[model samples]
Target: MSSGFDPLHPRELDLPMAVPLRADGALVDVTSGEAALTMDDGKIFAAPSDPAQLDDWRAQLVSWREGARARHGVPRRYDDPASAWAARCFTVAQVWLWDELFFDFDAQRFTPERFLADARERFGGLDGIVLWHAYPVIGIDDRNQWDFYDVPGLKQAAAALREMGVAVFVDYNPWDTGTRRAGDDATELAATVRRLGADGIFLDTLKKADPEMVAALDAARPGIGLEGESKLATERIADHTLSWAQWFADSEVPGVLRAHWFERRHMQHHIRRWHRDHSEELRSAWLNGVGMMVWEVVFGVWVGWNDRDSATLRRMLPVQRGLHAWLVEGEWTPLAVHEASVFGSTFTHDGSTLLLLANTSDADVTYRPEGVGWQPLHAGDTADLITVPARGIAAAMQVTGTEPAELDAVRTALAAETPARDASFPHRRTRRLAPQIPSRAQLAPADIRAGATVRTVIVPSGEHVLTVRHRARETGMYDGAPYVDEWKPLPPRLHDQRTLERVVRLANPVRVGVAEVSAAEYALFLDAIGEQAASRDPERPASGVTLARAREYAAWVGGRLPSEDEWQLAAVQPGFRRRVPEVWNWTESEHSDGRTRFVMLKGGSAHESTGSDWYVDGGVRGPEFALKFLLPGLGQDASPSIGFRVCWEETT
Candidate 1:
């Protein structure tokens, strides 16, 4: 009478399976649950990894599949090769469109033909693409609305893409489970996949997918690729899953690489999302052996795809093409090389090994395998030491066993280099000059004596455009030595020493503070707001405050944080003192290194050279960018030597 099947003690199968049955009607032998059994679908069915569990989870799965056939009359299992889908998804890209933002009904914009052409041209060579929230036309405005079931031309577009040898995958939401068979969400989804001729579907926000649904979907179209949103395939429902190796900035890679070592080879991992930084683009692909999915704003998105970033990615196509098998299916071994700051991994395929090293610290790092005669391979160059610049990478292939001559060369090169130092200050310790004149730190709202010398610089309003040249070199590598060949601006950062002209339209003149907000001045604002203030040294710049808190202080002083343009304009004005106490200053604009939100910090600090650290986008609000340590009991372990400078719109 009970419908639920117990995983511990699977009941005997009284009836035969509906279809695709084995010749012997081979059922799951519950007695041999401890033994590993290969399923008809080429998936290994075994007991859970934990030793305490008495029942085999895989046997329970076999019993559950049979029960579904008796209850729902549909067979989801098949003898298809599991790696078929992953092999097809070698180079995947993502596509989507917004409502009316980049489209015009009259002009007939964002047509399927146009989108496909642009994607082909932009992505260069893509095997598959995952369509996200892509409706035929921008009919609805709500982003949360799925609107997939009734979208016009959804099937036609999918079929067209499939015709071009590109696999088409549509988004599916499994949480919309319903009770009735007619209204069953899985049934509808299965029908949609068939109707649209879609090759696969991406299940969003699901830790595990329902087996019945996965079965029904397979029954509709055999061997269809099922992709999960999460990096881990907790439930064996998907062929491959989206691996966010670079999500939260550089936080996810190590754990992801470790997980890849244990997971099934057929179950592939693909890096779907990343920050604007292109430095990690190739590094992630080579290190993790995962594919990259680039989302170009073909039509609808807040930010369109940068052509410059695309060109940078295109350069790596040759490497990806050559190492397809090794990069896609090779076994990953996380390496512990000499440098503690440098992270290393090796991908081995058929006795051939490729080493990947990434430098997280802000300094050049040297690494050599213990006993492998691996020459640093970069378009065929001989190097004694494999040096990776700050926030850079180095890769090489194992050519032969370690030779004493090769090892000696590496050792000699490393010995000749200067001893590694902390990345913060490269050359020498900086000294701070005491402020001779009184600053905002020493004054309060009531202490405003007329003619107190509150120096302010005025920036005239107008249409201003300027071209600036910036190199893609690391912070401490301003001289551009060994990395000169590797130095090139990717994305999110400017192209290597490339000149870019930007236009800024200012409607009115604005007055900006001559110096950064002092610790004493920030204390008055904190007290007025009934919050405890940190150190109250009038001469020191405010140190213990977040970007949001800095904005509050700026507001309390009858001004606001300046935009990147505003900050730059104000600092360039005549009579604008670059430094008083010398601290990093926060701006209103925001930039992200993928994990943390950072406001630009500018102005020379006590620990840096006199003219250094002065600019619009100065310091990130992260411990990695801190120039000095803050006083104890500040609630945070380390705070960047940073403060805020306020700016007001001039009405005169």
Candidate 2:
């Protein structure tokens, strides 16, 4: 980073996501900066709050749309009949493939039904989900990004999700060039998509796919939607039907999402993964007649939705799912009615008008628009005025020519499902698994060390504060989001070396192994226990073992895996040593925030993948350096670049 680069306080990221159209026929040029970060929306956009300025603003907006379409040749959303799913995909979610809610660890199966059931109950249901498989955990070994998706039964999981009417999207890590190669990326990705029967591909890191990738995916699945992570270029919007509206800060008077406004059928799923308050994003999506990305578990961190946002999503989904045509094809008007803190947008089509209202204020707002025969879609009885919940949204429809059956179903569902008023942030803390101190742990250090399998170092009992070093990736180690409300975390704020202090408490002395358990020793243990151990080197530390396997081995020996604290404490001891080929050692500090599971790893491996910042903790690291590894499902936790050290809580 240069002398003045401050990633957290990037001025450009704080700007509005909507382009401003001044009344004086002047438009800001939005295509100045890098194509990935810059879109149709100029960074410093200001939406008009005064009602009188809206018409001219809208006229300029329309003119810009016309000019942009002319400048950039049309692609797919306009005429392609096959790419119609984008319009109806109002609500999508991004979930880790190994999310506890999605995968059954004990059953050893993908619980698609359970996942879908929870979604239906909480946020009505999901139209699609991005099964985020790799990156963050990638570069752990020689296994490339594709290997994560190549897990056994993964195809069956995708098939099951599709069977349940939920579209499955496989994530593509474009920056995964340094890891193990499986043919070329395009070919490997398309083949994986075809084999898994995936409907879409989530492009990680990139805003849009290159022509070659796009062609490859199109050949594999003709209508496969390529949804990018952040902003999508204007030219690419024709083909990439979906865009992720991540970290897009809207104006006080909600501004239209640039992509959605440019092409009505283009789906922009509004999401701020780290933000605790989703009311703003939900409201913005509602008024724009666009989409919302429900990301409860963001990169193995629990940033789950509150009751209020979930209820709001539930209220909009029923109507949006049914009358998506109105949102995409109808006449859309933003800021149609301005009632102080309450703002609304009206969508009209076929003698019917739908009004989506959002109250940005803290208090409940009542608005009486000059209208008749309005059927409330927000579960409200209004002879005159309708109440839009505080910091929430509401919708109502007036059908003139033959009331639609879809509207009736929507109304019925909306009436039954009451919206919640509570907008409090739902916080879930990651709890560390309790360590079972065996009888021998309390004995003198000499007694515990006498029969140890390897050289051991004692971590004395007491309160000790130690500094832990980690890279500030999106998976903020054991806490809230690292980037709250900040847009597009840059290199300085992301993947930067940061440290935090951990105050550890121990009741008794524990002996941590000086060296990681060797393969020969592990094979011997397996033989004694009548367990089959295969493909062992005999000399190297036991690698490619799961946390469960490591724990089981420790238990059999009347000991346990060392907690990260103990490992760090014993690392500087005189007898502590590392094997010839170093590998990350799994610790007992496994934690769960209910939605996601992660464990700590001490030391670092030499198997560092080059070419991308998305890889796991790499290079030979010091004792204090720890990696927060999110546990993967489908027996994928057994990584080759990882080994273990036992902390003896030896039994009598």
In model 1, where is the ten-residue run with the lowest total lDDT? 626-635
Using Cα atoms with residue i matched to residue i, what is each candidate's TM-score against the true structure? 0.43, 0.91
- Please report, in order, the local distance difference test score of every candidate based on alpha carbons: 0.46, 0.80
**What lDDT does candidate 2 reach at residue 145?**
81
Output candidate 1 Cα RMSD. Answer: 21.4
Model 2 residue 3 CA deviation (Å) reads 9.2
For model 2, give the 10-residue run with minimal summed lDDT.
Answer: 436-445
Top candidate (lDDT): 2
lDDT of 2 by residue, 27-78 (tens): 5443333321344644223467788878866765666667667768656554
Best by TM-score: 2
